[model samples]
Target chain A: MDKDKFFSNDPRFKVAKKEAWIGVGLVLFNFVWWFAFAYGLGSKSPDEYTYILGFPSWFFYSCIGSLIVMSILVIVVVKYFFKDVPFEEEVQDIQNQSDKKSS
Target chain B: MQEYFLGSRSMGGFILAMTMMATYGSASSFIGGPGIAYSTGLGWVLLSMAQLPAGYFVLMVLGKKFAIVSRRYEAITLNDFLKSRYESQWVGILAAISIIIFLFSSIAAQWVGGARLLESLFNITYPIALTIFAFSVMIYVIIGGFRAVALTDTILGSIMFFGTLILLVAVIIAGGGVTNIMEKLIAIDPGLVMPFGADGNLSASYVSSYWILVGVGVVGLPQIAVRAMSHKNSKSMHHAIIISTVFVGIIMLGMHLIGVFARAINPSIAVADSVMPTITMEVLPPFLAGIVLAAPMAAIMSTVNALLIMVSSAVVKDIYLSYFNPQAPDQKVRSISYLVTAILGVIVYLMALSPPDFLIWLNLFSFGGLEAAFIWPVVLGLYWKRGNKYGAISSMIVGVTSYILFHQFYPNAFGMHTVVLPILLSLVTFVIISIVTEKKELLQAVHK
Candidate 1:
């Protein structure tokens, strides 16, 4: 079905293509976020005794701070970006299908 | 509960959030993980954050599709989804076998963790502790079923939240300050303060692989994925995701940090798993210790209850009814479920009799097994229409076999965790086999 969608203009196909991309984008964001926090900020040791918010500078940003930041970030993305995806189909599609069945 | 496995599927946002959080935050999250952090230093704390995106992945990848499709088929267990999608009895059985084997190992580990927590808190022998926990969990699950389990998660989730918060504050005060603790850590070993971990052992490859182990691969865990199919609507799903994410974030960071700080208070703690209890007792009075102790006890009990229910449902709903007696009376099904739950509890209790001095391996094995076996099937089966029974069955067999082989012979292959290789191999198997068999399925359809 997706193979022919390239040449098709159905609105449902467009929603699906967009939805798939959104899913991929969300996954990629999570991957990069974890790598940067766990390996990037944490890759170095500075002054051997540097402290931030009672955590080692790297630990504070990467582990503790990142957790709090991610909590808010996920909530925001889910609220504003990710659409409500009902798998069965749109409510209108269901009503139309039921009418066809009865007819 | 209208459905034995999924409850009424009318869960509110709060109950949905609590059940997801409680199930995801297992005994290892409370006890074994922190114990590892106590020795591994601040690096493990950062590594633990890899789990922050766990609930995110389950809700996102499986999301609305799983719930709606499961409803369309009236499926209950995770294996029920497999049976319906692939149209194969083999797929269902293989899924059931994987859940029982891996989750049983997981259950035994949790029982050990619960018993250990009790031994430390109440000063009792190990077997006595095990008996008390086993009966308490079995009785609760037997009496209330899934609704009782979800409601208990609400109470347990609160205990986890305030419990960790209180312990974190007390630990910080006892260590003088976070700054003071950092200095004390550096004094003991300069490596302890670094991101690379104590002795610079947490390699870049090692830490990055955790992204698969705890982050994305969590979508494969049946216990967590089943929660995706139980919400009342999209709004409830959305709310559950946000709330569970916040709860997981706070507990993982706070508890692991307390593990690291335990070093500052008592530098010579003998066993790492004992770090949480020792520090909680050292920092707070006995009464508060009891309260905070409930955090881990609740963590373990809630996790065990969820696992017991899942394994029982797998045996009863997925295997027995699907194969032997599809038309079995409801009363028979009810009796069988109760009997299976009790038998499973007894088996796990016996396994935990002489707990391993270190239990990370048993728990990790279970995690890896489930991921290697189920991750590709669940994810690809849902999205890729071409995926077939050959693909599903082959993926399961190849996955569990390679996982065990790699685990026994070649762990941390090329400095990466053993699970990475099996998940990759199984995925390659799934896609290639699926494409190969796609033509046959299409041909049969055209002939008809």
Candidate 2:
């Protein structure tokens, strides 16, 4: 129930916050690149094009580029973002509240 | 009175029922149905039949354990439940971001579908129709929250059920009967009335993969997942399962079949998405058509509103409250929630303005993305003892990244949906990482 103790002092949460920033970084990167790709090359006709593995050149590049970026974000979150912080006290408090209400 | 959050009691049972139906019955049934039917023919109807068991599958798989765990954690939203169950901030963030991104796209698709339906019916500009549709939803959702959404869904669901039945009758009557329609379809192309879709292009690979996307994978969707946690007990869950299955089956089959049969009656119709509205106007009288058309609009608006609230909640509740400002006042949280929801709606509207070629594909793409991002994290977190933060993080990353990659380059990579590969890959990653990182301290606490 103590907000500061529950969040601020939790070492695991600090790690989680840092990992979230990594995710934020990935989102920002993808957003920018997608905007650029859409504006710069998305307008080109197939006649003015290159190809990759039987697909249009622009489509191929966009697919690979976005996947790489999303992969990086996923890696960061999985490797460094999550923390196993204990919330026993909070769980107990919630349980007590439910029990009281039921009775 | 406060227990309305548990399940509607003060709100009449009829209203509650209506809300449930309306919320669950979506534009996928209305606009997407007729559109698919027109393009693929009777095969599309058979393909749609996979959705009949969706509600039962989700509720049964999740069961009572899911709800108990969610409530035990004081988790109000599906994101909230996932956050607590996994005990992983990364899972929460991934779940939150995926919901925001994909649900925004999904909402935009619905908005476009709603606006187009209105434009056809009322002779209004697309922009005006969109504005009207958006405002009507925003007002009710802002006022009523989930309760309003559920109640409205029940009403909309009833309308959808009856609307499909009535339209089916009308279409059969207008087409001179099922026998005549079948002969006409046969004359044009025998494949049109066949169960494999027009031109035999439906493909076993694609049709079977939809069972994962629309059927089994629906369990992971946050909007639907929250429903499992909302029912009062196992009894309500059982009742809901039966009711939702029958309702979904009737609507999906009826709408898609009507679409396939429309071609026999009006062979000259172009722009497949407009087939439903076109067919409705032709089959029913004007005033009746207006009312009947509202069923699709109802489906669209209900879906849009649910996604809006969900995305906004993810932003306000999961990210902002939990991470950014844990000490913020309640009033501030409330205001921020409202502001974020409105802003998100605007962004989705912009994205939807120039929609992709196939609206259903766009919606399904979002569905696949969310399922991949959240399924392992939520499911494994609940059942597995060794599901640690590291595994949760890894599962989400693998799930979402592979989903995007597969969707882009090789949509049916290895003869399966993009979601299938990612879900499998993530489960492997989760097990590997969880085993490698397991510690006595982390393993000891179950309740925590």
Candidate 3:
């Protein structure tokens, strides 16, 4: 087995790396928004808390609010940015190229 | 054997999403998480939501390249991927051993959860319930195979989603309203309404560290990672990412909220794991109650099914087929696979006989260990061209050992979960070792 030919010899790996970065960004956004709201407003005493939709202001913004935001962002990003690549073997092309050279 | 293990990798978006959800949302999320929420209050609910983006992380990180690479390698299992990528027999064997050890405990915990659910629902004895649950699972796994599990997951995932919603609405109504529930919870304990647990046990550092345990590091789980290869195309992968995130959000948020709200309704409930089912019976009609109760049962069954298939494949495909019987015929492999699945089911059933008081810890323990061991190897193997077998083997060895040591002796070291330190250590070890070994190999090539 040729070690150098193991990875897909095309832009597919690049596409995956880009998508992975976007995923990291989305997750970071989720954490930052959730942490700020959950800790900022939620640090107060219950009596000191204001309620929204019968939830503590922080809880609403942090859990439910962040969830809705994440869903929309995920849909938009995956729709616009993510590529639809073939799931089959890309290394086959590399093998063919090497075989032609050898022949 | 390929179809038996991976359904020939022909799954579409919807089945892919549902199967991943059903497999990931185990008894821990359904039974143990809510139980903790019932005791810890709203903070635990927030903590559990850290798992909301789990599907997003797995699919997005391992989405396209993982599929292409595995197919190129002709890999059917996670260990096969590791073995091919790292080009080391030891790497494959170590991965298989890790899966068997960690997943064994997880499967036993799920069995215990299934039996306990039955005992509470039907007034059946524990042993009888355990026997019934084990047989049903073993029979389907032996006969229906991976396709059956995937198809059944569509139904089970739906039950979990709608059941959580229905039971949540009922609980809110039974408590009079959200405001009423909040007030009651406040009256019982004001801390219940805050971001921290009722006892302030949920610190910011601790809760945030769960992002690794259940969130980002979930990409390392073999049971979940293998699903990345099964989708028909990257289009389905995209669809699955969004669909799974939404499903996970609803189930995790709704179930934990119901757990917290149960405290408002019945403040004196003794056992915490019973909170979900107990509240369902209290609030909904008997018929509706039965339907809603299926949510946790769905969670338990689907999870056990996935784990059983994974462990079975580790034995038959990764170890047996690779090492002992590489030239074994398809007919021989098929029979051996079924026999192995049944035998593993019996072993887990025996383990479940002595039930643990709280099974979530066992599940979490397994999660942390698997994540630490596999995260660096899998992630780096995909992106970093320089990583070699030396790096992979050392990373896994160091990851598992340090995780156990930290979990045993210095838990919550630096106010983070036990997993954080091991992950960091393994990453460093992988990089340094891989760089050193790659240089040595280059020097050898020059000399030759």
Candidate 4:
């Protein structure tokens, strides 16, 4: 019951760790994009505001625009980068056996 | 016990996504959120959209390792995961206590919102409405358990999505289109059209910090994180990440937009929580409004059901079985589960009877507390091998205490949410303590 080896030695852990970082990166990206448009374009007085498709430009870009873009980006990341790992208990047993054979 | 608590961990992508969305998009988003948006204007919408990445962050962060490890540990609840990860009885006890206390407030918020929605929708008295909502939710939860919740959440989640889209369009049309609504909102208050609030109360820092409360920090919500362990496989988990992100983004954006636009049509509504129902009844025909209003009901019901199940499991399985009656028979455990769920519903119902002015604040307060308490222990415990019971126990204690003290004395300290400071302190505590104890454990191992 080597707990450290049990987690770290599994191939799934490495992939999951990598994906979690990407997940965090995506969240940060969402915040930065949201902040830039929300605060950057929105900092001006409301009198100087412009409209796009009936939405005020700042609200349009910041909330609606980010929603569309983040949705697409999340789908792309999951489709391309994320892998399908088996959840069955036996998969770990198989993984252990394979590891023994390789070593 | 497995089937009762976790639906035998057999949920697929759609059910997983729906259950997660339905659970996360609770009375706050459906009612309290929109109510605030009704007054605060489009800036509040932008602020609420901080929740756009909630499902994505939770599933992605806790996806694979959480599922595999929980399965390995035979864990059913979040406390179960904590108990095994730290291998400390105190960690499990502390987690159960936290879940019961914080989740009670949140469940009460949902109850208040649900009763209010019913009161507004049916023109019924608040007490009757509260009773109706409580009875229906309890009956199904006590009888059907987790599978019923997941299955119903799928239907309810769809209702919420389409309901929001319909209400948004209806509100727009009733207000003479998007351009006209914008013009009217501007004429009322120029700030209404800006990224700041109608009163310019929503500052940039406060809004950005919400990303932690509703976005990334969502990984720490036990109700949501528990879903990460229940998905059938990694492929479905991937599908769920995409599906839930899309659903949450649209529902949040649409509901908030309806709230803002409702201001243009009916600027005189008094209570913020009533804005959603009032506007729906105003804009749509009676039949259509009835259907649209059910969306919030669905949201509240599903959320309450999920929380009820979790709390009952925490009390019955985590506390009772582990400590009081380890050899309790299946029949007794089942009866105790039903009894706990019913009693919890009654207590929350009583709490909701005194209804707060803004249930959203209550909801978000609980969110901050839960996130502050569990974020480090759960996340660090999953990743860092060195993290142990001391780090977890210290982090939970520090995080929960500092969060409460900050929330009490100085909410939104430094223009950031009160949750920000405690989460930072807890992270530091977890790392330093884990490192210090790693050496101690190493010494003990060598002596052995």
Best by TM-score: 4
Judged by DockQ cut-offs, the docking class of candidate 1 is: acceptable
Candidate 2 structure lDDT: 0.67
lDDT of 1 at B118: 81
The DockQ figures for the candidates are 0.36, 0.02, 0.62, 0.69
Best by DockQ: 4
Clashes of each: 0, 11, 0, 0
Q: What lDDT tens digits, residue by residue, belong to model 2 across residues B211-328?
A: 6687667777887777666765434554565466556656776788789889989888776678899999999998888778878987887787777778877898889988999999
For candidate 2, report its TM-score. Answer: 0.77
- Top-down lDDT ranking: 4, 3, 1, 2
Q: Interface RMSD (Å) of model 2?
A: 15.5
lDDT of 1 by residue, A51-84 (tens): 6776666666666666767777778877886555
Better of 2 and 3 by TM-score: 3
Error of 1 at B345 (Å): 1.3
Scoring only the A-chain of each prediction against the true A-chain gives TM-scores of 0.52, 0.60, 0.80, 0.82
Candidate 1 chain B: worst-modelled 10 consecutive residues by lDDT: B1-10
lDDT value, residue A22 of candidate 4: 92
Candidate 4 true-interface contact recovery = 0.80
lDDT by residue (tens digit), candidate 4, B43-150: 999999999989698988887888989988888889989988888999998898888889999999999999999999889999999999899888889889998899
- Among all windows of 10 consecutive residues in model 1 chain A, the one with the lowest summed lDDT is A1-10
Candidate 1 regions exceeding 4 Å error are A1-24, A45-49, A85-90, A93-103, B443-448
